[model samples]
Target: MMNRFICIPLCLFLLSVCNPKKNERPNGWYYITDRVEDSISLEPIVTINDFEEIKLDSAENLKGKFIYQITGHVAADCVEKWADATEHSIGKRIGFVFQDEVICTPCINCRIETGSFAISAQDTDIKSIYWQIVRKIHSR
Candidate 1:
């Protein structure tokens, strides 16, 4: 009886500690931001961890597509943020940032509600860029 009581409380405490707040960013995750700080975008509206998968696919014009699927546990919050940001910043640029670098900047056109999105890659070496992002996220 004594062990059960202690264990239940301990489990509850651990669960609470592991539950990340909606505003918290996972370690080394990339985020979307509208503003740049110290020449780099720092504030996180949504993070890479919110996405289920990020992939690189071939496209026309010698470019590649950086496709993302926002279908994980944080999908609701992630979709909300994305829609809000894009809605507010129509015709303005938003950035994808990791650490101190702005990895990609794309102008918002309209409110995006779809869970999937793709950004065109400027580099021809799409495979390398894809691996680089994967490595960066894992290196955290």
Candidate 2:
């Protein structure tokens, strides 16, 4: 009986020591400028400039039917140039430069995708542009 009691305590101790949970951070992306000034821990993995080429993921069965909503502060110079060049409004246009080219990939529970859009304005200097990409999940 005494041996059985000791064994139970030892097994419990060993089980506790053997299994540990992992430290998981939030899953998402953010666009920031001046990595040090932003007080943000996540470093920017990608950078974009005017007229740069960006690639987006493609979705299956939902191709060309998804809606993208983009919102961010654009540099004043970019607004002026876009106003003169395109019919898109600088104040409300999202995915203006990279429209119709985003690609979606199958994720664990849903699809994940990302794309970069260019802002063109000769005189505007934008400090940072924050954007998010969300896809409509279809029930299977």
Candidate 3:
């Protein structure tokens, strides 16, 4: 009986130390901003009948000066894009936009069905121009 009690406490302690709960914002709209440095634009150059790899240009790197904004929806029933499909309840929907350009915009829809969520934007060159994420948004 005493051994069983000690084992339970030890297991609980180990679990607590090993795995900690992640932090999540309250159920509401939130803004996430970050600037990607040394990132290249993955725009496609030309249209080819056959499969061709796209090239990227690394001319300008975004320093901390560049600011990007994401309008995030925390609730599940906020907006419905497709019919006959259940909207994501726990995960949030984020729309990305650059603060300076205002006109030029690249919005990506992201979600975490099981694990981490990542968003990447490709240009005409089919190269990845921008990438961001809401890290570890879900738990098992």
Candidate 3 global lDDT:
0.29
- Whole-model lDDT for model 2 versus the true structure? 0.30
**Residue-by-residue lDDT tens digits, candidate 1, 1-140:** 99999999999999999996543333222334434534333456566656545666643443453543212222565877767767877787765554344546677788887645554435344465456656655765
Candidate 1 C-alpha error for residue 49, in Å: 1.3
TM per candidate: 0.52, 0.24, 0.22
Q: Could you arrange the candidates by lDDT from highest to lowest?
A: 1, 2, 3
* Sequence-dependent TM-score of model 1: 0.52
In terms of TM-score, the best-performing candidate is 1
Best by lDDT, which number?
Answer: 1
Q: Rate the local accuracy (lDDT) of all candidates.
A: 0.56, 0.30, 0.29
4-62: candidate 3 lDDT, tens digit per residue? 99999999999999995553322211222243831212221111111112122243336
Single out the weakest 10-residue window by summed lDDT for candidate 2. 103-112
**What TM-score does prediction 2 earn?**
0.24
Task: Evaluate residue 140 in candidate 2 and report its C-alpha lDDT on the 0 to 100 scale.
Answer: 10
Candidate 1 least-lDDT 10 residues: 65-74
